[model samples]
Target: MDLPAPDRLAEVLRQRFGLDAFRPGQQAAIEALFAHRRLLCIQPTGYGKSLLYQLPATLLPGLTLVISPLLALVRDQVGQLGARFDIPAASINSDQDDDENARAMAGATEGRVKILFVSPERLDNLEAWRFLLGLPIDLVVVDEAHCISTWGHDFRPSYRQIVRAVRTLAERRPSVRVLGLTATANARTEADIARQLAPDEATPLRVMRAAMDRPNLSLATVEAAGAPAKLAWLERFVAQSPGNGVLYCATRDQTAIVAGYLAQRGLEVAAYHAGLDPAAKRRLQREFLDGRWRAIAATNALGMGIDKSDLRFIVHVDVPGSITAYYQEVGRAGRDGLPARGVLLYDPADRRIQTHFIRSAQPTPEDFERVLAVIAPDADGAWPNLTRIRVRSGLHPTRVTVVLAELREQGHVEKVLIDRKQVYRRVQGTDTPLDLTRYTRQDAVRRAELDAMIRYAEGAVPCLMQALRRALGDDDAPACGRCDRCAPPAWADLPPVEANEGVAGWLLHRDVEIAGSRRPPMSAGLALLDGQLRAPPFIDFMRRRTQPGASLAPAVIDLLRRQLDALARRHTFEAVLPLPSRTWAQRDAVAALAAEHLGVPWGADALAWRDAPDARQGELLNNDQRRQNVRGRMGAALPGATEGALLLLDDYVGSGATLAEAARAVRVAGHGGDVVPLTIAKVRWRLGARGIV
Candidate 1:
């Protein structure tokens, strides 16, 4: 099957679209598509992934079905395609009006639309599938195809339904060419796509990848001293960098807070998240794109369909769960082949926040089984329609929808929609009850997958790229030179410190006290104090007490615990604990007490020692040691470096002592540099203050 040449595609590209030439990797993908084979194209951002399907949509006869994960993306593509070409392109999603939808369906049936954009959820409708069956689909393109894979960073349950629809379409039209397009697809995603789409044992699928590297983007990371320090650093970074940038926060509330903070600092900014209304989001996006706004503070929801190419910077106030997500988000910058910066401000405590998020969404085996039992009481009996099932199951409509989808994939049930809602009917059609045990077993498998994902997130391995490779079944793969660990800056290479040398003892003591004395873990205040003492004689004192013959005073422990409790109650410190755990609450009390009484200037030596080669080594250094190191280094390098004028950067601040200490060290270093400790972002210490959740 000889395909057309680059010049031929180029000729078509110009004649129809008035483009000079195909973007890098565009011609190759189009040629592959012309061969009438399934194609997987992995091109970087701004490489014109849409043209791979759009160009073909023009040349190939009949309609082109483009499956997209996002409604905004579909709308954008449709609008762009409709602008130049006379061909009809319509997006069918939940947001469309009834009349618009009817028109779209009619156009598709009449073979009037060249490209029909739809969300995977649209395929859940049996009517839509039947309608699609009537049309002649020249090519079926799945955009953001990585979402179809469970191993992908951003997995949507609805995306799994795509396989079923593809299978249905294949049965109706065997010659339809399937094209999966994505800007980022690692090995796991590629394999998952192939397994779902082309499962024949004899017909193995091949994944074609474009280059992943983008030379224009410069990546950097900074170790936050504490919360205040991190925020301060971010503020300075944004002030120094170009205006067109995005600051990505991990949570919706954080997005708003960061945006507000930046706005207060005299920068024109807006916050964006799924929590906002569609109109507001669109307005904010437009404002930012049109240069009316200088920056945006957003959660993960902002980037999927965003086409802004002149973005100059991207800052992550919190660490992303995986490198894949990090790369995709940061890849939004430097798309125009212009120099841009991708900065990550990180803190060790932020891990707790991410872990909580992961746990919240993890559906247990029990949950799955419960959902299945509601959907399929009698596997052999006729499945009830979606409305009846929804009413009978007593589960939320969304969950019911997902469970039916799972059943369909397992071949235990089939789905059809009556009046727009999905209905799951038993496939076997025997009058026997479904074996609930089978669902339970499947639930266990899903639970294991969730566990693996959590373990992958929490793994201590420094190489993120290697971890991803291993997860994808490539254990011996080389490191991705683009990750934080592989290309760490020279500043990240500090000397190692002993575990017993720094704040470990204080932290252990606080942990033990919180476990024994406090009803809940120590509050944020207590944790701050515990962190502070860990940098000093407290660590040495704990080590001495641990010796076989050493006698420790119970009174001191009691005093520390009381101090921690008071600080927590006073709301001087903030502490976070996930549900199903009480130990953190107890530790919080101890930490609060230590924070109140242990007020001392942190040494620069402590700061440097804490930022040691190994994370464990750094945790061992005392606050004073870190402060001393910072002062010594800065004093020698900067003429005006002084304790009062030095700036310390941290990711989060439960109590402000760490920042205070960093400031004190600058003053003590004999230089006039003001020690201004700043946090990249901060959470509310008081539960009732605002945005605590």
Candidate 2:
């Protein structure tokens, strides 16, 4: 490896980035990469770690590929590097349309783009892997590299394959340089990252770690007994705080609850979480960065390599999962070297939420079998592509991959490359019984982690900051006199409200979101499905009511009428338009009864079912099949005006196809009514205690 001249490197650094020199560990990282050594750099946040690779990316030849975890991080890096340093950069992410991503791929392929930011998920995506295999990648930088380790606080199974990607890239670029960078990682996590990123028969990865302390941050823990008290402390923090800050929540619901609380108190606040729409996330991120909003109540999703330097305070509504997570989140504040506070509103009850998460993350033997049951063999007794298996399994690709990986480890399944695609097949001549003993052990590991976090939150004798530093392998770390344990704490008293548990009854009167229904092209807002259609009585009711000589009992009829009436009261529908029927042809009797009960006129002729072969929408699988089954099946009846404040009613809704088609019909007829969809039972997935979930 030929190194760049000292003067040349200086000129490139100064002229390109308008910088004089490197941060403490940056130059060494860049030099290590240039030497074709696998590098692991664990520097603190805002340490100009991007320059370690970004500068070299400009001077080096071919493409410098950067794999980042979040779309926001990708956009931020690309935008900054391209604008400030005059480097041609492009990124491929889900936020971009296919054509836009293709253009980015083209730029990388043509060697016009010096650096390309990509999603870590792309490493496992076969199509994306094929595209990258063509590019002569000189350097591969894995940002937020801690995620690569299962022991890592923010472990993602998708990130573990990045080293495999690096090894593949080495086939094209014989001396491809790989660099793993993160802000917070314990010694164990750092070693795991280095081990994962190191290729077979190569020199071990070199670890470069820096101090983990942030002296500017004053840490505190307030014992706000429960959720309501946490919100109460949050109100004062946002109100009294000078500059913009972030309120971190353990879940999306918590973000909404806290953000709503602050917003009602006349503060400009927004919620950022995984559940938010991409456009909404982008908007809130931009506004908060531009200092438009006073604060953002967000889940762990908000702050990453995001460059917000002037944050005044960091508040945690609940205990974080680990010390790494706690340190990383609090490190977000006071990056400008000004004084700021990191406050945790401690509550013991919050441990249950995290414990539940830790338990749920580890899949059971049943999960493995569920995925395996969907696997089909070809004529010669081989399996089909993963996409087919994934479709049949109805699981997320990441989760399916995890289960498959576990099965492979257990020697229950094998992945043989069939025509260049890895198709999985059950191991021949083996008894693959469901064994869940390993997951229990893994669960213990997570439980121990949670317990340690709880100890830190409790602040028993040791300072919270010191406990974090010690956990992250920092020895001789003196007390900074900046924590509640080391110094007198602030905000000892805050108004408390009784913590409410369970679902609120008023939630039934409210409409939540069903954004990506299996039935496509339907505008996406509706009341939550209080229960699943498959639940005992409802399933039995569906069978009996759809029978030829059946009539819905009066009690059942009244119960459904109440549900529709509650929804109708919310939307104030003036008329009821019963969807076209299949089981009971022309007799939407129960729907008419419900409309009469609500004092809304029924539109029998508003839309009629087109004569077609009998097909039950519930029996269909996947959105494509359901959409094809419902297409053009319902249209406005001839010589009838479909206009009013209308409520669409159906006996039972399963893929929502019939209701979707009827709604389309109502719109096509130019109905002047507000169309509110109501149903007796809905096919729901992952129903929670909160009906809206």
The best candidate by TM-score is 2
Off by over 4 Å in 1: 84-87, 225-231, 376-402, 411-414, 418-693
Please, what is the whole-model Cα lDDT of each candidate in the order they appear? Answer: 0.58, 0.71
Candidate 2's TM-score: 0.77
Q: Could you give candidate 2's per-residue lDDT for residues 1-693 as a string of tens digits?
A: 577777887888889989898667667677777775678898777566778888888877778999987676676668777788889999987767789899999999887899999988777666788899888788899988988877678777677568678877876677788888888788878888888888764678878888878778888777778554566557766787789888889877577667766776688988788766667777887888899999888886786545688998888888898778888888889988898888887888889778767754677666687877867686787685666665566553455667876676677876666677777788777786757675676577677778888887887746777777877778767887867778764434433334433223222222333333222233333433334213344555556756775776555555566666556555666677777675653246766776778786776777786655255654544433454667777777523454445667666554455677777776676665456666654553221111211
| Clashing pairs in model 2, backbone N/Cα/C closer than 3 A | 644-673
Model 1 scores what on Cα lDDT? 0.58
Q: What value does the lDDT take at residue 112 in candidate 1? A: 79
Question: Each candidate's TM vs. the true structure?
Answer: 0.61, 0.77
lDDT of 2 at 171: 69
What is candidate 1's lDDT per residue for 1-693, written digit by digit as tens? 247676777788898888887677677778877774678877766677888888888877778999886665565567678787665799787657678889998888877789999878777667776777788887888888888876566666688868777777777877777888776566766887878777365765556776666666766666564544555566566776775998888877567556755676687878887756456766787777789877788886776566778899888878776566666787789778897777777666666676554444444445445655655545646456765554454444445555666666666666766456566656665344333453444344445444443443454555554554454445576665655566666324322222232232323333211111111111222222232324443444434432444432455556444543544444422211111111112222332334334332222222322232221112322322223323322222223333222223333343243444343333454444223222212323321111222
What's the residue-level lDDT of 674 in candidate 2?
55
User: What's the C-alpha lDDT at position 464 in model 1?
Assistant: 51
Model 1: residue 31 alpha-carbon error in angstroms = 0.8
